[model samples]
Target chain A: MSQVKTLALVTGGSRGFGVAICEQLAKKVENIDFSLYARSQQGLESTEKLIKQIKPSANVNLFVADFGDIASLQSVWSQSLKKVNFSEYQRVWLFNNHGSLGPITNVSEYVFNSFLIFIDMDQDHLSNFKEIESEITLNVTSVFVTSSLFLKEIKSVSTPIETSVINTSSLAAIQPFDTWGIYCVGKAAREMLLSVITAECKDTPNIKTLNWSPGAMGTDMNKEILVKTKDEGSKQFWEDMIKNNKLVDPNFSAGKMIDLLISNTYTSAAHIDVADA
Target chain B: MSQVKTLALVTGGSRGFGVAICEQLAKKVENIDFSLYARSQQGLESTEKLIKQIKPSANVNLFVADFGDIASLQSVWSQSLKKVNFSEYQRVWLFNNHGSLGPITNVSEYVFNSFLIFIDMDQDHLSNFKEIESEITLNVTSVFVTSSLFLKEIKSVSTPIETSVINTSSLAAIQPFDTWGIYCVGKAAREMLLSVITAECKDTPNIKTLNWSPGAMGTDMNKEILVKTKDEGSKQFWEDMIKNNKLVDPNFSAGKMIDLLISNTYTSAAHIDVADA
Candidate 1:
């Protein structure tokens, strides 16, 4: 009989921290299975290729879905389940890593005659209602829905498997970021959701939930912050971090995260700042 | 010719803190036009009657609408604008007072074999997916949509009016409430939204925003907490407050809110705890 595998479900696993995480896991664990979900097929394929190159015998499946849309997420989730039966897995690790930075414009620059011109700007453009909604959907609502669905599926399994949800969070989750209004709100909501879930699942021995902030990383997100931000102060800060090599490497952060997960040292619903760890 | 009236748009103004706010504003300000929105027409009528009893000449208009429904909110907002043109008022005070106390059970009692059973419970019951969504809609989404619409209206006005959004917040915004997961998340989002808006409107002297925590109040919400909660600790805490008369009176809190609004002493985007005020 084939040995049952430990399944890992990762959202936004196409590139950046997601790809780094998959790479680190492939190096550390043998005979592990991966189901990576992302919006870009090309990115997903690239990530899969890299993982396969690292571990020749690894089984890597890619699912295309936009976290911003509920129907798409639901469809992708169901398809993923069909590909990998929950009962066959000894353990399940869910990594919620997908998020968007949305429009990064200075609040001060948007002022016209003491009024925020962007507030009434066209929705088709950046920093409008559409962008704000998209940010919230991708960052907050998607995490909430995906985690809830995963928990439900775990509950339905005939043979219970050890499961844990690691939510990708940021300093923005606790601190208010200027010009990143919707994003900050979304991150804060994400942390609160994880905290609440942790509290709710206190007695469930097989389930664990944690919010993990990977700190500032030299990823596409950081690049976007450096390139897209109109705020001089914010731009300078990012530029300085990049120049001084202050940003954390995605591989290092991923390694730390995997170490924490495998050790199961944090049994409670606590936030783990990877930088501190 | 009648002097133009300063208009106040209050959501969830049928009862509780909403009614008290309307009552106090009527008592303090003369020629203040009030537009109260709530789901219960009967409750709105009763509130209007109370306002008139305090200030017989108060122009109190009741608009029946559910804040949770977007269509209903939009229709009511437009109807309110038609009733009193935005140009007619020198100032507008938007009191976002609507919220729901979602699933007030204690986290301590929910442990099952060292895990929470409610995490996988049916959605039809209490503290499920449906209830969580409802709480978010009423508390967070409603505030976002209403404030956005209000800002849009202010932008369109040919004659600018000094407008401010006073979001009725709670300690729950800063502190996590175990069983009130959705409610706590919603409140936190509300505060972040207010902070973002404040940053956006830093240059706009005509627009101001604040998240005001009215402290513990003896209202219908308090009654609900006392009656709906199954957690012994939470029950005892609230009961003790009631027994010791520690809860602030709704009218007194409302009076302080009106004082702050008129004085406009708080210009920054900071949370106002009534007890501190």
Candidate 2:
């Protein structure tokens, strides 16, 4: 008889914390299969390679999908399902981690950019409406659709498996972050989405949803905040954190996240900060 | 010179609370102009007629715009701005009242529907990806874009005027309503958008944003909730409220909302429930 394996699907499983999560799960969990989705093929391939190096017997699948594009996301979801026989898994987990910081600037600069970009700003600029829409789509709407798809896939399995959705949230979801307008709203929406899903799935014993804030991690996202932020105060704060070595290590944060997920320490619709994890 | 008028722009201003708001404002506030946007021409025309009937000399303009469509919204916004010079208004108010109740069903039925619709559901059904996208765009993104546009318009004026955005919100923004997944997320997103805007505009003394929760009102939205909801508990609750005549009158709620807007009693990003108003 074949052994039942655990299935873990993660979005944004290319670089930064995503790669750390894949590596941590590969090292910690035995007989687990991974399905990773990201926009960059190179990044996904490298992460898959790292996971294979960690667990030589682990089965890793990489899918290229842009969360900002619904069509691309749907295509990847369908393809991933075809590659994995979900019914053979003893447990299923979906980690929603893909996000974008959008435009970061001071309130004055944002207001100025709104007008500047309104008249002549390039469409590709971060300040444009299209970019804002893409950020919101990638950060919030994509999670909503992808998580819904994951739930549907879980329901399709003949045998009930332990299932959980760990939504990668941020402190910005609760607190106001100046100049990260779209990102803040998107994270807040994600938290609310998990809340609604958690409430709706209360009767369904097999499924659980949680919002997990990974805390201040030393990832590419943080690097972008430090380098690309236009707000002097915000830039200084991030710089100070980096200089003081205060940012959480990606590997450590990933391990804590996996621990919470495996232990099922949080099943309710609440935000779980890494410190609490 | 003609007296400077107070201009109010309302989305979904054709029926229910929107119409009530326009009527109440027309009757109560003198030297005020109205710009109403809605997809239904008949509704907008009738609303304009009612407003004109109430105030014979009032200037009421009706614009056809579907909140779900960005192009339509931009066209209407431009047309409205062209019609009314911003400098002519002593105060500019935007009522983000347009919204949609995405889907209403019990968890079991929703799961069943998900499976039923999973294979054959048009990608555009409320349960499908497209519908969810549209609902979010209409309920959340439209408000973001419109409010941004309002800010831009306000900036174009030579003289500064008191500007406020009163976002019509719901209890679902904070609470989880089973089967109303997208609606709940959208409302929450709206609240967060208001929050970000409120924070960003803190130093800008001219602009203020408020999320107004128009409690249980006997409007079409409430009737739909009572009739279409598949959640037994929620349906029962609404039915009890109706049976007990507990739903607030639309006119009364509108009056309270307008009073809050004019008085600027609530300047913060907090959710202002109608009962508190």
The model with the greatest TM-score is 2
| Model 2 lDDT per residue over B246-273, tens place | 9988898888888887677676787888
**What level of docking quality does candidate 2 show?**
acceptable
Off by over 4 Å in 2: A1-4, A105-128, B1-4, B105-127, B156-158
User: Which 10 residues in a row give candidate 2 chain A its minimum summed lDDT?
Assistant: A105-114
Highest lDDT: give the candidate number: 2
Write model 1 residue lDDT over A24-114, tens digit each, in one string. Answer: 8888776688999999999999999988998888888989989987556755776676677788788789999999886664332322222
Query: On residues B1-277, what C-alpha lDDT tens digit does candidate 1 reach at each position?
Result: 1364678888889989999899898987777888899999999999989888888877888888887665566557666756777887887898989988866643222212213445645322333333344455667766766776677677678876878888999887887766777677888888887777777776677888878899889999999888777668888999999999999998899899888887878865678889888
Residue A216 accuracy (lDDT) in model 1: 93
